[model samples]
Target: MTTSHKQAPAFRPDWAFLMRHPAHLLAFGFGSGLARKAPGTWGTLVAYPLFFLLLALGAGPLLISLLCVPLFVLGVWACQKTGDALGVHDYGGIVWDEVVAMLLVLAWAPAGWAGWLLAFALFRLFDIVKPWPIGWFDRRVHGGFGVMLDDIIAAGFALAVQALLASWLPV
Candidate 1:
């Protein structure tokens, strides 16, 4: 005689799931992760408005940059919880990593649209490509810290490239 087993349905986060828990909401980038395609890009976009909002409210680059530390800590917890629920440690929809990392990149971004655009493009490129140590960490790391660290590294890459360009270019 043989026994049959059933597989669990894949978790698809809708507004209800996102709203079900605070972690889900944050881990999903407050709904940006729900986009049908390019959720990471959408999640990264979330940082722009937030960066400007903080600026409008009197937070400077120094303060915003400092804020990334705590935000990263929070993302670790939120991503761990959300990932556990979703059963995929780095679910594509869990994009708080992008949000926090982009915030870091934007914090140091030069003061102009051109600089910000370059920063965004570079960040996305590093994140998607995950070269060398970035790819190494992404594969070896696990859990919330893992989910967060790789993106932070990508942010560092973006910052480094931006610095190089700033020094070499006139603007």
Candidate 2:
């Protein structure tokens, strides 16, 4: 039989397209978001190393929290611009929101890899599952605020779960 080849599906705003704008470059997590699969998860993984570096630099919870505010605020606008360029709101490849939200999670996470692992797992779970008000906002809200809120809400849930785990799990 003759060999048959499968064509790969195209991903949007490929690096060249996103590279035209700095905002898109960042909102795309410096290209981590460009992954053909599970972009958001890749973006979160990108955030992990950065957070570890910050921790190494002795960035305590307060400083990390302080840093997140601006990222969250700026991400709103950056995401909007990138979305407009991509012709889709909150495109899977647009993951600055995940980056900032991860920062928020890490800011409050405990002082070791175990805690970091827990936070990452919890954040990803809540983000993907989108329970309760998170789902509500995801459905009802639109645009940049909408894009960011669900993750923020997910972070809230993750924080709560982390708190509960801290109380009981002794990890």
Q: How many clashes does each candidate structure show, in the order listed?
A: 0, 0
Worst 10 residues of 1 by lDDT: 1-10
Cand. 2 TM to true fold:
0.89
Where does candidate 1 stray beyond 4 Å? 1-9, 167-171
Tens digits of per-residue lDDT for model 1 on 137-157? Answer: 998888889999999999999
lDDT of 1 at 147: 91
Q: Please provide, for model 2 over 61-168, each residue's C-alpha lDDT reduced to its tens digit, 9 standing for 90 to 100.
A: 889888888888888888877777666776788898898898889888876778888899999999999889898888777677777888988998999889888755
Model 2 stretches astray by more than 4 angstroms: 1-11, 168-171
Clashing residue pairs, backbone N/CA/C < 3 A, model 2? none
Top model number, TM-score: 1
Best by lDDT: 1
